[model samples]
Target chain A: MKDLVPERYALAFRLYPYARSPDQDATAPVRHKAIVVGGGPIGLATALDLGRRGVPVVLLDDHEGAGLGSRALCFAKRTLEICDRLGAAAPMLDKGVQWNLGKVFHDDRLLYEFNLLPEGGHAMPAFINLQQPWFEKFLHDAITAAQAEGAPIELRGRNRVDAVIPAADHVTLEVMTPDGPYRIEADWLIACDGARSPLRNMLGLGFDGRVFEDNFLIADVKMKADFPTERWFWFEPHFKSGDSALLHKQPDDIWRIDFQLGWNIDRAKELEPARIRARVDAMLGPDVDYELDWCSIYTFQCRRMAQFRHGRVLFAGDAAHQVSPFGARGANSGVQDADNLGWKLALVVQGIAPDSLLDSYDAERVHGADENILNSTRATDFITPKTPVSKMFRNAVLTLAETLPFARTIVNSGRLSVPCTYDRSALNGPDHPEMPARTRPGSPCPDAPVGQGWLLSHLGQGFILLTIGLDAPESVMAHGLTVPRLALEATPELAARYLGGAKGAVYLIRPDQHVAARWDHYDADAVAAATARAIGKE
Target chain B: MLITTPNLTRPDESYARLIATHEGLDEAGSHALNARLILILMNHIGDDAVLAEAMRLARETGTEAA
Candidate 1:
């Protein structure tokens, strides 16, 4: 067993040693169907999704275990559903703090509280707050279990990719291990190597965007407190004069607190245990007993590479783009990136789809990144107003929110993460009238309770033809379409949400559960054409 | 379009409410609050042409006072 993780942090999963050191097999380069660099949540998810699709994947990571701290603590509902599909959400939900309400305060007075998920009947909550380490552990365990069950996923710990050479057909990687260095060839290379992506640098990709001038001090503390498991954000909190503070509860009696520090503050002094303790004491009152678990000072940047795809080398997660953590978009979007790329890459690797299908991943995720960046930038601007005028405007909005309903609309204290809809993709079939706008082409199929399971649970893993309140046309079977067709009775819930005012509908859904296209009536030709377009055959 | 004349039903009451909203503020704070109020009103009346005309009228009237 490799003892590579920090002793202070618990390692809940086993770390596998690197395969094929220089001494073991130096002459012949081992070839893999896909190689995912970085063993973070995104990389693990990509590998897991590919392995589940029967694609042989080799995952490399420089570190031997999970991340050092509770890096990204909030897991959005979409992300949880994606994890559930990958067989990792159960443990996360079981050991995570589930909450939907968030309270925002201006000074000591409470401004307002918002409910993320007011209605029920969904499989998961709006969000789950779990330590990133535990989340990664759950994913790691899922990958290990899948491998045990004959899934072709190879997790290589302490395997660092020193160099990347992109060829016409494949990518070559030089990996360094404890024993020595070895080379490997991959048909497709996925870079999930995080924000400071070494693979991105080796490939000479440029990441351009703005880096905010503000810094934040984050401390994860364990204490027994009666605070509710809800998100609390304070602007100019009395404890932290002229600054903002955020408090969120996690499992294991841990609370994550973030304090906004001006740009000129000393990072070292802010991170000191004594200073952190002082701040915590002031915030929680002098008598509260707590122990600091981890502390770090971070500056956020909103940036991305111009292109996520470079020939056979693809980028996902932080390696591809970065955003301020204000909106919890970082890890959530990365997970979505993995989910979006996994099935497309599987089809391409299996030679079932043209390589051009992978282009849709770039198009879709770049759109997603832009949305995340835009929302995060707005939240950051509102939280840390740079100019006096902007600050005054923000303060005025905060003031007016107490009485004016319209003013509350402009209050942006980190708009929570929601899955982006790929509304403008070229793969969507023609739109039809009398359909609900929410379930239109390129949008995620909203989950609703079916007979025993949710609607999302019934779709995906391949092209699915969902016919509601209608019989499958013989033309669909006559065409010998490989897409699985599921005929569902139009229950009231499904009818209202999916069918809308239409009596019936036929929906062609992508493998990632995004609605590729929908029509009021069954049209085999349209479905066939949309399927082809979806696989980049057109 | 821009409201060139007073449009409030009770101009004095509205003015008093506006002043009351900035009761505890000093001179600089009052000016800041007024600037913010203008921005909020501008956002509410989103028509650019109306905003431009209102700005022009305010500038002209202030110049005449000067």
Candidate 2:
């Protein structure tokens, strides 16, 4: 037995130390008090988050081993920051290739490369590309460290969970381990299983959305090129076809190419490596040679769970939605799901906040998932160039875009984000203007250089007040906003950005970086009222 | 490579760019700042709405959504 602190935060499933435990009997399948099924990024992140918080959890996965496969190459900056908070970010930072710009090309000729990283206040480069295996190893190590520290994350790898049924207080799960059948009970269950999540199906949840007719062949190829490693896309990309290839560097020498085979090609035959290789060889030129590392045929799909939660059993990652990877939504969104749920779940499991606080998880992240689905679909539509009319239009747009600065900027910006906010939600109100001609409440916050640290570095794990003055500058702040969360008034150096030395602006910020509300002057009443709404006090 | 510049490390040119992203600047000030920001960020990486969103989200919500 280990100490209470370590016992509370151990990882659950999917990964186990290769070394035999100092205790010989560790191989026996011990019944867990809480269970999380599936060892995908979402599941593993959840398990690690739980263990770190001292929650006894059981993790199960059907995979033969850890994520050794090649998949999702571009890990977004936001995801890195989230992982940083989870304590796995440092290793990830070192392992992946930080990228700032990506170029688009057609027929080996230049089209446009979008530069993705520049700051408002982001901590890392916009995104990094690495083989999923390398990143997975980093996460696996983090989970093990958290577990060894005594929050034991018990793993039952090669274990397929046959069924999970939620009872009033706990979940009854039937799992088939390598050693055979066993029944386990846990106080709560979280199904982070992927798109084929049996757990969600067993619960009778509907996975609803459109499955794209387009088939794409994604191949990891060893090719030497003079191209920048940071470049990600190529418009009119296919050589045999009009233009439809997206190429990106994975690590350094390895590049990934996703070639659209169109709706007409047999999804099976078009994806066969031999078929794909024949096409790749043609595109690279008759004389050029490229070696293949791994290949897979993919179909872009837009889908989401009808419900994220039913009582105690919850869902995250691909279990909730499967967006196309175009905007790097699938993996990036999953990590965000883990970040959002991790803290709230810990608080709920520890009895810090009311369980209802957990409901906000669905409210916040589901909306984001919906937004991402829309963005990815748009990106898919823009780049697809499938229909003859659409292809012609896309070609015209791209050709004209090169000559026209405005069009190029628009296309470029579409790759980046527009300031989006959830200010429209019930949590966000109409007290201020619909979008203050300038400062919209609940808008995405940009990064600002502030004293001691960048203002953003100060925002992890709590609420913040961006008022014109100091932390206790206003007489009203001395009384505190009605919102129950912690509020740290920014310093005088940074205070000028919000409300300042003058009758300046004041903003009530939520932990997730959505502007709850803002005002030009310090009105104790308005500030308190806005704060109340922000923390759901109203 | 990613460093948070504390306030206006160089106040002469940066003051206008800083004002536009946070609060409203007057016509001349806003135009000048936007142009400078466009030039500044274009050289590094195109800084646009995503940057605006992160800033607004951080300032308004107090905690970073990222």
Candidate 3:
């Protein structure tokens, strides 16, 4: 059993070896409040969120801990913010290399550069580049600390869920462990298994979408160099290793280089260390010295399941939707999924809200998945043109982009991932026209500095009524829920973000820090209705 | 708003100039020039509604001929 565990997990943290729980010896399967499968970033985060909310959750994983390779390297600002709320962002931000600038190149010439966050008073940077394993490791560390503090989060390693039987009220699962198979039931099951979701397959679901006819080889090389920490992408690179290449800096002086190897290549030969070193040598020239750390060839698809939720079973992360890795949306969006589902699922399990509230998770996340697929597909099309005419247009845009500023907008290396706004969600409540559109209903609450702490830190784990320059009750009880009021004097940044031209404003922020409703001024009835509507009462 | 009804004054001159701009270009160069010209014009017609209407008309004209 120990041999099956990857060495990477041993190198980093203690593995969660399978332990004999009493459920295995029970005559009847014991029921859990929430059961999350696949202890990747999404599952770990979901369990952590639920446990923090006092919901007993058990996470099952086939592997002991994080797998090999630095798969998902770019953690966006929104993901960091979500991690911050989960009490795991400090280690990530400390270890991950932060960068906001990206430069695009054609052959040997630099076309233009972009700053993801041009202006900022936000707490987190635009993005941070960290190895996926380290990202998962930090989450595990936070979970360990939470467990010490008596958070009811249990992680079962080597517990592979084999079969799922979903009933109206609970979902039964047959989990395989080193000790043998055990039966358990969960009120709600979250499948965060991954792009090739075994649970999704077990349910006989369809993952339908376009399969791009291109391949990329990621080679993480450890080296000591003084290259600026920024994303550099090249089209028709001068190195002649591939059609396109991307270079990014990661923690521990390791750099990630991706070469776009076209379809119909020998996968085994391309992964050979000698071949990979040759490509690296060409890209780096002779002066730079580096050691190859890890290499893998990947073929991506822009595909997703028809629906994220079915009966009592829910899907999150790559198990629900998938997109090309160009924009670094995979793990980032997965973390966002956990953030969105955590509070709602907790409420439903606690009987504070009806099961209908979970439907909003499906609606909002599906909206986010579609937006990610569209952007990544467009970026893939630009990077790998399917037709001669399309290639001509892409090259023309690149050529013009060298000199003209307008053409720069058309050049798409990869539109980096950003938070998705559920603009048309049914969960959205009233919006004040005078308020800024960026913070409208269904948008994530923009963070601002307030009294030596950030505004987002003030709004966590429950619904908040953030009133600025207005008088409201200390708390409001509506529909069997208590909405706490966070009154503050309007600061410059807060006014710009939450209150545009409006003199005073009131915002109803959901547990996930997304705005559910807003108004020009505080009203008790409006607040009650919006809070009810946000929980899917309407 | 997109003006499909005789919006351009001196239509002949405009057409002549468009043709004259590609006088010395090869097939690939001519195609690139046309793409650039289309991009510039699309930027000038920044309104999404107007640009979409023009794009639909352009595609429909090709399909109609086909």
Candidate 4:
């Protein structure tokens, strides 16, 4: 941590964000041609992805900069694979705290502990927890740097969006700029606006979903404790009247605790410091001292938009769905929404693919949104049961799980993330010799090593030809696939683990990284035929 | 068997009795009613597509005029 960041960059907190106009008073004319309303991680990730592809984007946020709050931290192996595809992987790895095991507790009892690193390939490359603002700042810089190189994603900090109007073909956005109300036009509009999306409601979309009665108070503090810094330590729920406590580490030895407020506490009193101190005191022995850095209250909601598109106007991230921040899905899935949309928009803008290709965005991501909502709900339900009988049943099962290996696997798979398979989709291959239970062809492209670079499942911008063999086996040939980009690669270890070393296979992967098709023998003839049919090349 | 129709599927007839809020409902009452409505709808649609689409549409403008 010390060696990677330079002293000049260490003072980054003070030098960056370059204070801008107050969102409420200032009124600047239209600054961005296509404005992104929120500057959270998803919005910034979207800005970076688009800026790199020569698309000018305007990112606006009311905050002077990214929030100082420690919101989301965990990154899954799947997410890291996506990050690697977007060129944000290296910095993320350098700045985060990594862990690969998940533990569960039933009151004072340790119910189960499953080590995930081994399951995801010894080093797994998963679940990195970093301060959300750090990534926000990193992405903001990435966007600026991309602009300096060529096309930059325009950023209008401390600016607020008051109106959005979707018209024929192009969408016009009326923004309450630092100066006066200004309007801008774009070929498309996306509401990465967030859960309280004014843009969503302005469109009359029903945010039909469940809001858990439970509330949580998250406090960031600098503390010294004997608990291992790597695992999510869960305090006994019963000891704290059925609330859970978390210990997450940030840079500079700062830790964040997400204190799950009991159902009985008044929502208004959830943020009182005395209530927070009491919870912390319960967790500590008589001696350890900790200083509170910051605190906030948040409730959990599990909901997704009924549709991701309203004509040319689209919604991504929080603007589209809100999940309990339990299994690291909220921000990760939202960033993924940006990655999925960036290339689709670029291709359509460049006249490479018909605009209808955007339909695939909704087709794929809405499903992914469902998956996130479900996972977050499962984690939440397990941590906080609704009824005493269900709590007792959950505890009994968890207790039984401690002695049973198979049962623990079932529980951990949902919480820690099993590899996502896109089995029943239009993009996958017909039948292949190398298809394994885990490697179900259309599933998210599995990780493999190709020379100095990592061969990942989720390619950011275009279709990829992942040919696995010792020396480019010539089996997976790309001939008629004409969407964005394609590439070929291999690794001995990946072949053994995922592809089962059948002299490898050729995988025609889509821009979203779902395998379009794969074959043991790559006759440019057959591969080309499959690619044509998959992308409607006929 | 009824497949989850996603965006195309609305709530069943029985769900009409459940409202976003009941008379004299406080925050808790409103939230509970909302949850019941969602559960009923989810049980019918099964797939999340419809709600995801609704969210996207709503964000495009404002609270759905429906």
What are the per-model DockQ values?
Answer: 0.33, 0.02, 0.76, 0.02
Q: What lDDT score is found at residue A222 in candidate 1?
A: 94
Chain B TM-score, candidates in order: 0.85, 0.34, 0.93, 0.45
Candidate 1 per-residue lDDT, tens place, A1-538, comes to 5543223344544466555544238577877889999888899999999998899998988777785788899999999989988889999999999998889899888888888864566788889999888899899889888988999998887788898989999999988776667889999999999999999999889999999999898999999999998899999898873299999998999999998988999778778899888888888897889999888889989999999999999999999999999989999999999999998998899887889989999999999999999999999999999898788888988888877767777889898899889988977777767888888888887888888888888876788989998877533432223787888888877887788788898998888888888888887788888888877888
Best by TM-score: 3
| TM per candidate | 0.91, 0.73, 0.97, 0.78
Models ranked on lDDT: 3, 1, 4, 2
Task: Tell me the lDDT of model 3 at A356.
Answer: 91
Give each model's clash number: 0, 48, 0, 37
| Rank ordering of all candidates by DockQ, starting from the highest | 3, 1, 4, 2
lDDT of 3 by residue, B25-63 (tens): 999899989988888888888899999988899899999
Mind giving the per-residue lDDT tens digits that candidate 3 earns over A1-538?
5443233243344457678788889999999999999989999999999999999999999878887788899999899999999899999999999998899999999999998764566888888999988999999989998999989999998888889998999999999877788899999999999999999999999999999998899999999989899999999999988999999999999999999999999999999999999999999998999999888899999998988999899999999999999798899889989999999998898887889999989999999999999999999999999898999889988988999998999898878888889898887999989999999999998899999989998987799999999999999999989999999999999999988999999999999999999998888999999988888888
A492-536: candidate 2 lDDT, tens digit per residue: 434434443334456666555556677655566676666555544
Question: How far is each candidate from the true structure, as Cα RMSD in Å?
Answer: 3.8, 14.3, 1.8, 12.1
Instruction: State the lDDT at A514 in candidate 4.
Output: 60
lDDT of 2 by residue, B1-66 (tens): 223456556776677656547576676555545544444454354455666665565577765453
TM-score of chain A of each: 0.96, 0.80, 0.98, 0.86
Clashing pairs in 3: none
